[model samples]
Target: MSQSVLPQSIKELQHLLWTAADSDYPVYVYREGPQDGVIIDLSKLNEIIEIDPANLVATVEPGVKLGALAKKLAEQGLRFIPADTLFYQDKTVGELFYEGCSTISSLKYGCTKHFLMGSEVVLPSGEILKTGGKTVKNVTGYDFTRFFNAPYTDFGITAKYLLKLLPVPETRKSVSVSFKGIAELLAFIKDLKASHIVPAYLLWVDLGEQSVFRTDSSGQLVMMEFDGLSEEVSEQWKNTEIFIKKYKGAIYEVSDGCSEMASKWSCLYRTTDKYVLTEEIKMPFTAQGEFYKIFYEKAKASRVKASLFGQLAEGKLNIVFAENYPQDTFIENIIEAVEQAGGVSSGKYGRLTGKRPAGILAELEHRAKIALDPKMILNR
Candidate 1:
């Protein structure tokens, strides 16, 4: 079992890093997985350092939970765009930023990286590195902020963050319509893309027996969320209804608050005994239909129960598989199908089949790691 440490202050964290480096002890920032060495938990560092309503910026500690921050910001008529999804509210600010978490709102505000303006990170060498600042446009030097955006390699541990904020929308609404098949759904999506009305997110959910969002009937649900001034949202909904009627879609639900729909949508991320495996697939809009057809056909042929949900505009899909399924061969087959359909799969299975970046980019990453953690004690 790995030992866990919670540093109370930046100085203590630096000291711990220095000691670990000197002793060649592996140190890891706590994430969801098994660890072989020391685990650094940042929960004690939680704090909402500052909220500048005038500038619409928030300075926060790594351990601050996003849900708490949202409530606090809402008090000031402000919100963090990428965290609009109610589910993300449960995650800490640091976890969301470091993991590059995105939500249905990503269609409008982009991802977590777009909202991050600056950060203070503690290097594995115990050196404190500051990048960006309170201002939105602070381009200078090497743009080290980008380097620390996701930090999949655990290059450094973030201590503080400067995040961008936006005013809370006056009204939020959602519309769900069910389509009998993928072709009809795709046609509706194509029209929505060309229309002047833009949604906060357009989700395509495929309901199956194992899906938490499954209904008495199995089919596809296209959900669109609109948020803005009340008049604007009302207008968008009007235009959306026209498209739904044109596509011969059966209106499943129309919600004014959007809370109920968002809650149900969050079930896509939930895991259960029956639904044990999940994978994210990214492809072009043109290839999305083919990819889905091929993937679902394979699953059906193999007797594997699977369901899918994803952002339609983003061309990203999440597939959930039944427990104790033939994941190895199934995943390999899916990856092959994704490539054939002109797309890519990501997750543990995809990583094994994906090729790493080569040449100068690879060398630069290597040098950066070596320079920041010469002893290689961080996240060892």
Candidate 2:
């Protein structure tokens, strides 16, 4: 494996990139490594540059941790919404946007790209480039801000960012419900949709035979989170309770609170380091039930222990398999099923930043890479 470079300042980073551009070595940027060749470690750059409460925007260094920033914002009665579906406390703001992470709140707040107002990046040629502006209504030439979101460091390293913020909700409540079967879970969700109940996020998860928590019942769990004024959250909770009861599902307040909910959701969503075979499937909302139906049957037939979970409103599915599972054919079956359902698969979960399939999207990325990193010294 190649060594790494830890730059403390933007000038140092640019110099490193410039030298790399002059060389034949490939460059890669990551917070942690196994990143081969020239690895750029950005840990020292963690800083919250500015927080403008009046404008509801914050400018932060790429290395700023998501949890830390959220806490800082919380002190001001604000929140930094991330697009990541799971709450990874250690994830940096740069990593979140670079990887195009999604959060359960995506149903209401949109993805990581949506909150990104602008960014400062060091091009592979060691030149500094800024895209977009602090204002939300910026109408730039090409809107390269969106293009750079989750570019996999193939174009450049995001050095700084301007992120939008939201006022913190007065109250937050989470409900965890258990269902005996997929049919029951589906019924509950159908009712939930029909009732026009919009929670911050609604997640349905089924960690098969090898699940770690609450496994005694061997049933699926659905978790819903509501945030707003106290009265509003209370009303939503009341409606949710009645709707869940009609399907005979048991509901309970998430005892520990939002932090606990985030931890549990992250645990369920992320594959253990031991299990490297993980996949993500995203489909249209209309096709979720059918996809799940087919997925469960195939998973059963294959006897692969699959931990399945998704954002109900957003129509995204995540599955993590055991380390030694037969992955090739299994993934093929999954892709085929997803395609049949008029859905798309991101292939690997968090790692694959490019959501579009490899043809046109690949071509576009190639062109963008050339435009931004002409030296081809960046991640390839």
Candidate 3:
């Protein structure tokens, strides 16, 4: 920890963080390979400790990487099952949580919001606010952890976080099956749920050409991964194979290699490789599938083609468009359709990308910034 760069006051901290046009912000630029800036890096801390060890709740400095946290827990035969970052070995906890970033596995294990238990954030006033408890049942007051996903950087600055861990599944497995269209995909998903497959991550990847559905590589190549006891993995894998066979799908790879590849599915969401890409938006999960099938179909037919991925169980979706025409209309129609399906759509995505055109939610977010961070010194 370099005291020279660390700000002890709120106003000073904000300035130190994002300085003028030269400073790097996650939204404007998430990563720059070997170089990056504007982060809460606590490199001095050798290791972070859990708030309540018996309860499996942890309080970690912002510098901890998700993979490192996973490793720490795995030593104790447990896990912090968040979406693994692309740069798992490099991305910091502060970068992951504060940058409002999610990984390839978000569809199953969930985003930061799901596993977070509490936090110790430095507010715009420079006061250290301690919030949330070690247990899931400790819902005494408003939860600050959940707020991490709802971007309003001007209102909050989280440095230390408390997270909940899960017992590592003794048997882990993945299965993939694909259909000709979205309709078939939905049907297959429904059947999987009916059969109680209980996948850690359920995903749909439209490669604009060939698409496979399986946790591992089968001949037809729909990708899937399963985790649990050995008996459980064997049973689930066997059953999944039978189910895919019915779909006339072929299985390819199996075992460890299959599990490793299943982790790559989320790579489709990466924008860095494409360069000059538009902002990625997120919406409610149920708002996209059968819940709003008509709307999704209409979207596909429209000029603006958006790719959709979801954490249906978590009620969230990550949407991105390959062709960026009719951007406003596309987003507007999607939000309207989502509202029709009974869900709230925030302009949180707008803030994460560091761009907004002064809409209703955008206005509301600005007001929040003014109210919570009147000084306008927080990272907005």
Candidate 4:
């Protein structure tokens, strides 16, 4: 933990940055609390600066919660589709980009970085660094507005963000399906993909070994979400029902009216957070069958009780296990295996680094950081 400072206004924020630049200790931009080093709490920077409904864009402070901002945008019949799976009620826009939160809809909508139009950053040198522009397509220069995708800290404090928005979909629906076996489930997913129905999300869930579904069920739960025009959604729903029935699998549809999608997504997201250690494995969807085979075998051999969930569309597997399980060694082995199999894994709570950067690339990153934070006093 580090000392905390709350800046109520931009001037105060600038002064705090000046003090941090002069100090010997590193400073971290803090939202909820001090993540590391000294804390620069930006919670007071909560504000919805501007909303252009015509352009489907909004300028918001870093501290504004996604849920609150969504509601504000919804008032104008627009939505900020976040890159977070569960739509966490308390999660802020800053934390999403700063922490690089992964989302279920990433396969279709792309990641959080795509939604970021611009930002205002308070560099560690006590100077403001504004990047990007207010428009959607600004390819002016280096995308300094983009997140670094590290868990520790950014080069500076994120003050404000310009977010791209979308009109609230006219319809939204989710379908949950259970298969008789893993092979059967994979086959169904393969068929669904070939059918060309683009669901908002397709997630695979492990119901746990103790659950009733464990004994009587297929040991796999696949959830699919679809949102768009009413007619298209209805047609897809019907086709999906027929397709599932073709495999003799159980299917249930939960429309957006019940808010069931959010509830279920939240439940799965919470399971990952409840555990002490978790690692996300990313691979091609085609290799999921072989990858999961190796994954389960390793877990069984290690006697580790692991919960599994995946963003099926993007082929990202999220594995969560209790603290009692072998953490370091197991994760290292898993990462090695995943890489050997042409997959990628970022150990326990960080963005996946597909591969290690080369010497010059790594050096460039370091030089860029130093150029912005010469003292390394802002969240080293």
Candidate 5:
């Protein structure tokens, strides 16, 4: 059995780390599963330390939930760039940052790494290290803040973060359309990319005979959102509608609820079932169509149900599988298909399957781990 400790302050956390370091048992931050070793829960540390509106920066404790922080910031007519993605609003700032979560708006603002300006990380040996600053251009030495970008809890635990913020747009609107097939959708996406109208988010979802966004059509859906001045948003939407008509896409009559339902489109299939597997693949735009073709063929051949949703411009695709499907064989085949399509798996499946690259980079990472976590007590 493992013991869980919720440290309410930095002093108490440091003491816990120091005590854990002296023992032979492993110590790690508590995520969502059963684990061996002492677990530290940092949720009590949640707090919005400072919001510098003039500098467009927000200093916050690691445990602060993103959705709550966004609402607080909105009161001042400011917002965090990454919070544009509604699905991740419930996640804590530290949790999402550690997972390197990206938003549908990545087409416009970028990922969690881009929003992280600075952080205060606590190492396993009870040492507190500060990296970066409140300014956007704070790089005096090695970029230590990015070292924790991935879910690399083995490195250290982040205590506080200095995140970048943006001014709330005067207007925001979304438009939804459906395509007969992936080919037409890809063509339309290419055309939209070349156009001057850039959207906050342009998502492609394939629900396969199930309509979730109130669309009567069963084909693939493309939902786009534009945010800016009222006139700018309206003009961009008008041009987008014209593109949909040119592509022969059926434009669905969707409400202007940009924040509510638009965020759920990608995550609608997620469930608490132990057997359900969701994998995220990163690949070139040119390879995405082929990847999906291969994925669907494999899924159909195995008689397994699978659906996909992703950010079109970012070349990121998430595939969700029905519960109780054969996990090993299907995932192995899917990974092989992803490699064949010139894509890399960016989810847990990749790490579990040993798909991560090995070389000098791997050696450097191992050396860093040994140097910083000599006892291997952090996330052991």
Candidate 6:
């Protein structure tokens, strides 16, 4: 027979774990979020008081919010880059990682593994394990820490964690460059990387398609970016200007007016009301280029009049041209191309981060539920 496990608080967690036996049947945990979830929170038990940043590494109580960590780290001249996706600063890191509620900015920093250095996790059988370390160069023996810390809840319940952070860059900038062809844009990115004109945020705009780039009816477009500092960005901007002229591209100074222009690049969830947004499909950089060109031609051939909004900075291309057409066929076309051209398609944005097979994904999800609530006693 299988016994369900449950989590109450830190104190209750330890008390129940003390007598619980091993079980094979999975225990599912429901989170506080809309989607069902749960995890062991030891801070509530009083086993520990405070987990603070000691040196290069940080120890957290699992219930801490990333925003709070960033704010505190900022006091010491450090920052974490993320999509600013979190709705509030009060949510716990445990909720963020387990439920997979990370923002797009996390892409730049390398997802959970980027900031997560080490974790003190509580396994399903109530045994404690330590993985990874505080410093990049300090890993020892088996590197199981990162494995347990992933958003994959199939692993175990993460209670305490250690994170590694780098000193903030002296300069940070965002820039936009407009080009007629994808090839030209790639070349520009390559050139910038070679010249070391480092831009914290590098984005490309398709002047031909993106309405934000198109200034007038004549198809003239501009790129908007954040230039870091006076001296370094000046040099970088100059080099960018030189490249634009050689490539015959246009440059525009984007200022506060950018707030309105930035709407296109906003969060995908915001479009739920007005847009029947297709699931996000991910492919290699080159395949996306092909899909973009092909999709443009297909829409015209089918007389399914539409438009393209390009988020060049990120490798995201959105098609929103459908007015009267059944979206199923239009979406099917893209999915077909994606599969044929070596890309998998999903409408869910977060699925990309959690890239496991459907069967495996379900298994892991079930595991997460069990890891948080061992008795299978959460709801039942």
Q: What is the TM-score of each candidate against the true structure?
A: 0.89, 0.90, 0.70, 0.87, 0.90, 0.61
lDDT of 5: 0.75
Clashing pairs in 1: none
Query: Residue by residue across 33-141, what tens digits does model 4's lDDT show?
Result: 3445667677788999999887767898878887788778888888777823354556787777765567667756777677878877777666787787767466366
Off by over 4 Å in 5: 30-35, 209-217, 254-260, 263-271, 274-277, 324-326, 352-359
- Residues 1-380 of candidate 1: C-alpha lDDT, one tens digit per residue: 78888999888898988888888888877453245678899998888999998888999989988878988998999998766666666678887766545566787768667788888998887889999987756846767776875635567888998889999989988777788777788888888788967898787788644454446756677777899999999988888788888888998778886556567666554445656435677778888887777877888787777767788778887777656444677777887888788887655443223335346866787787887888888765
User: Which window of 10 residues has the lowest lDDT sum in candidate 4?
Assistant: 348-357
Clashes of each: 0, 9, 41, 2, 0, 26
Query: What is the lDDT, from 0 to 100, of the residue 95 in candidate 1?
Result: 75
Candidate 2 clashing pairs, residues 3+ apart or interchain: 83-101, 83-102, 83-103, 84-101, 84-102, 84-103, 85-102, 85-103, 98-150
lDDT of 6 by residue, 1-380 (tens): 33333454544554444443343333333232123333333334222223344555666666566667666766776554442322324446665565444344432445545667777766555667677766666566666775566553444567676666555555544444456777676566556656765444443334465332224522323334433456766677778778777776655444421333344444332333344333555556656667767766776676665554433434454455334333557666766777887876544433322344356756766676566655653322
Those runs of model 3 whose alpha carbons end farther than 4 Å from true positions after fitting are 1-53, 83-90, 99-111, 136-138, 145-149, 210-222, 256-258, 269-271, 275-306, 311-316, 323-326, 337-348, 352-368
What ranges in model 4 sit over 4 Å off? 30-36, 83-86, 147-153, 208-218, 270-273, 324-326, 347-360
Candidate that scores best on TM-score: 5
lDDT of 6: 0.51
Error of 6 at 171 (Å): 2.5
Q: Which one wins by lDDT: 2 or 3? A: 2
Cα miss at 26, model 1 (Å)? 0.8
Per-residue lDDT tens digits of candidate 5, residues 1-380? 77788899887887788787878557767343236787788899998999999889999987898889989999999999777556666678877776556666888777768788888888777789988888756845777788754564367788889988999999888777888888888888887788977898887778556322344457878788889899988888887778788879987745564544465454442344633435777878998788777877887787777767788667888766656544667877987788877887765665434355467966787788889888877765
lDDT of 2 by residue, 72-184 (tens): 88889887777223455677877776655566688767766778888888888888888887785673678888777663536888898999889987787877888877777
TM-score of 1: 0.89
